[model samples]
Target chain A: MRATYMFGAGDVRVIDVPDPVIERPTDAIVRIVRACVCGSDLHPYHGLPATAEGIPMGHEFVGVVEETGRDVATLKKGDLVIAPFAWSDGTCDFCREGLHTSCRHGGFWGRNGIGGGQAEAVRVPLADGTLVKVPVGEDSALLASLLTLSDVYGTGYHAAVKAGVNERTTVTVIGDGAVGLMAVLSAKQLGAERIILMGRHQARTDLGREFGATDVVAERGEAGIAAVRELTGGDGTHTVLEAVGHMPAYRQAIGVVRPGGVISRVGVPQYEEAPIGFGSLFGPNVTLTGGPAPVRAYIEPLLPRVLDGSVNPGRVFDREVGLEQTPEAYKAMDAREALKVLVRP
Target chain B: MRATYMFGAGDVRVIDVPDPVIERPTDAIVRIVRACVCGSDLHPYHGLPATAEGIPMGHEFVGVVEETGRDVATLKKGDLVIAPFAWSDGTCDFCREGLHTSCRHGGFWGRNGIGGGQAEAVRVPLADGTLVKVPVGEDSALLASLLTLSDVYGTGYHAAVKAGVNERTTVTVIGDGAVGLMAVLSAKQLGAERIILMGRHQARTDLGREFGATDVVAERGEAGIAAVRELTGGDGTHTVLEAVGHMPAYRQAIGVVRPGGVISRVGVPQYEEAPIGFGSLFGPNVTLTGGPAPVRAYIEPLLPRVLDGSVNPGRVFDREVGLEQTPEAYKAMDAREALKVLVRP
Candidate 1:
């Protein structure tokens, strides 16, 4: 089986690896049908420190159950399914509370000797709890949108949900990336009346507008804040969706969030320290929330919307490539040539 | 009129000042009946630079309305009222949303030439919005508890409410100060099943236990975290009310919070930066929230409880001082000789 690996910075390759097999009673063997490179994957790609043993790449995927251990009662061979970025036992306390990302028995894919999703076949632990069955056939066009249930779409939705976006809310999304666009869509789905997309890229911002952004601010930093404030009648928005995790993005989030509003950060933060004292969040009563999305909890609820043609989150993937072109997929996404690259295994 | 002023670190004085009079159409002059030295006052008492023009001190107070300007329609002369630490025009968007602390036209009591509460009389701006009239007399025994609605009690309740405390939640309050004890009472009022109070002072912890702390962990740092974790089945509490402003308290909040839990901080954060990255908040899906309590929004709801003697938040006040003893009051609180000091002007 061929899988994706990054040996060093900016270096990605598709190499032959041993095929995955069900090794535990709760495990299942999945033949990857679709997977993708995540924005988070770029973090390690930019500075992972050169290693002789390269790490397996990718955590999102939609696959078919090729084999299942005896204990896997909910799934059978040939079932189509989506896997969240992390695997969790559904019965754990956190999982029962709909916070599957915090499940005690859960772990991320491509870690702890687990096979990455960007492979021909991968072993899925806690299969009954981790995989959500998709009723559509393998050749269905909805597969692209359904695959997003694995991570990005759910992540964007989580930001909006955490920030308490509703029909009465005015929101500002501070990015034009895949997740940011999804946040726009999610906010719209949740009935936010106004959404401002802060991004300089014309193409991406255009897509953002189509997804539900009522206004666009093609500025950054202080100027960006000014533009958002101007759009929001000088009070800023009720919610600022921080889709870019850099310090400046965080700063902008603070700058443009209205007093008593919320800043929901979905981006994996790049730095360890940031201002949250009287000078920022505390003084204005701004709430700082958002983290790894419990995509497993969101997948089922969002699936019906995709099936009903009410949303097309799959539009985030502007390009697609086969297993051998996985390296090009990384290059294109890294260079901003592709918003997100779908990988066909 | 006499008012308390801080000339420098450890230097407090009560000096004669001009009597307050209605200055704006929305203003009202209130004769102080009860005012208190807050934990926050110790901040300036410890490090404020010496100056020829001393800064006025104190914000929380219950007073009798002496005079009202033409626009002050709600407050009448002789009405006893509670003034939140900040004065807001209740008509603002933030105030209408029940976040009066962020009211656009609001300002703290002791800044920008406003008279501090620790004075014989105060000219309160936006009188109709800032003052919540109490149906009690000046000498009512409930005066102490009603005074708490101005700041401390409301601030503590704000932490509990922001953390989403409910019957299902297990709460950990990280300070034994007045606000921390009030948080225990508020958590109990909100029906939190398990309440853990973490503080080293037996006297304060005893008070905290009386306020509804089901368990007390009198340890610090790693031991404190271990003790809290042990109390909550090793998963930590669902909500951590951080009533201490220092970084260590914030660290403890991060350490003992369950995955998907909330850390609601009410303390005026002393530092400008802290960790909220993958190693702390992001990986675990922790929500860091809280800021100044919009006491104006909470006063009415909590007033009924205090009036009925269902809760006694005023027990946090351990001492009393007259106007001439203001200097000593600051000294006693700064030396940890008093939990809180009630001042009679």
Candidate 2:
């Protein structure tokens, strides 16, 4: 089997590797059918001193059960499934509360002896608790959309839900990447009346409009806030979806959320500390929420929409690559040459 | 007119001051009938170099309107009323959303050229919006409870409501001061099934139990968190009411809130920044909300409870003083000799 390994900053290679096999009674070996390079993956690829050594790389994948351990009962050989960005033992208190990212017995792939999903074959632990089976023989576009359910799309849904998006909500989705675009779609699905997409990219903004953005603010910083204020009648938005983790993104969310409104931040925060004193939140009474999404919990609810062909989030994949081209996929995304890349194993 | 002034840290003095008079078309002059030394008032009494010059002090008071400007239609001479911690125009977008603290034309007492409430007379701007009229005749106890509506009790109610407390919720209220005890009462009124009061003072905790605290954790720091976890079967409480602005109180609230739970902080925030990174809130999906209570907004809803004898938040006051002894009231509260003190002007 061929597997993608990131050795260091700006380094990615697809090399022939031993096939994955079940190592525990609750494990299963999955043959990867579809995978993708996530925006967060760029963090390590661009350079992470803590991750100096080469390691197995992906967390999002759609696959088929090649084999299951003796204890696996819910799934069988040849079953199609999708794994969330992180695996969780679904029976824990956190998982029961729909917070799988905080599961007691599960952690992220690419580390902690767990196998990455960006390979021809990989081992999945806690098989019954982690994997969600999908319908067999889906079209390529639908497959790409289903692949997003593993992480990005579900994450956007989580942000919109946390921000309290609904028919009466007027929202502003920060950022214009794949996740941000998906947030506009999710907010629309949740019945938001107006969605302001704050992005500088013309192509992405056009796509955002297609995804249900009622307005677009291309300015950055205070000017961006002024633009949103102009759109919201100078009162600010009812919900601010913070899909970018940068300080400026958060600043925009805080600035534009109306008094008593909310800011749901879901971009894997980059700042270690944030000012949440009287001036930032208290005076206006803003609710701040969001984190790594419980993709496992969202997958079931969003599957019906993807199946019905009502939402085509896969339109975000502007480029596609084979397993051998994984390294170049990273470069294309890093250089902003591709919106997002769909990879085939 | 007599007014209480804080000359410096631990220095409170009562002195003669000119009586307040209406100066604006929307202004009304009110004679103080009742005022209290709030827990937060101690912030300035115990040293606010910024407030170094002795100024009339007090932001919590119930009064009788003695005079009204030509434009003041809602309030008139000899009307009984209560003022929130801050005054707003009541017509701003923020005021319309029940976030009066952020009102564009409003500001807190004793700052921004506004007159403080703890004096023989007070000049209230935006009288129609700032004052909530009370029934002509009520017992001192009811009046005291209504006084709490101006700040303390309303603040606790804000904390509980923002934390989303309800019949199905379990709550943990940090601090055992007047506000914390009131939070216990507010949570009970909100139908919280279980409420934990965290405080080291047995007397305060005893009052908390009377106010509806189902459990009490006398620990602090990590041990406090462990105790709460143990109480909730190692899962933590569903809602945390942060009524104390101290670092440890905020930390305990953040540490004990269950995944997908909320931390509503109504304490006058003392910290400028908080860590909301991956390790703090991003992974578990916690929501944070709350600030200065929109006391004016809550007054109408909570007044009926006080009127029908369903709640007696005035029990938080353990001492009584006259205008001449207002300085002693501050000393008593600051020394912890009294939980709270009420002053009659």
**Candidate 2 residue lDDT tens string, A1-345:** 889988888888887778887889999999899999998888777665534456998899999898999998899998999999888889997898888988989888888677687888789998899999988563445889899999989999999998989999899999998889999999999999799999998998999999999999999899999999998888899999988888899999988998889999988888868988888887678899999999999999999989889899888899999988999999999998888898998
What are the candidates' individual DockQ scores?
0.88, 0.77
Q: Tens digits of per-residue lDDT for model 1 on A129-204?
A: 9999988878989888998889989999999999999999999999999899999999999999899999988899
Best by DockQ: 1
- Shares of reference contacts reproduced by the candidates, in order, are 0.88, 0.81
Candidate 2 vs. true structure, TM-score: 0.95
**TM-scores for the candidates:** 0.99, 0.95
lDDT of 2 by residue, B1-345 (tens): 888877777877888877877789899998889998888888776556745567768999999889999999998888899999999999987799888988889988877666677788889989999999988553455888899999998899999999899998999999999999999999999999899999988998999999999999999999999999999988788899998887788889888998889999988777778887777777678899998899888999999989778888989998999988988888888888899998887
TM-score of 1: 0.99
lDDT of 1 by residue, B194-245 (tens): 9999998888999998999999999989999999999888999999999989
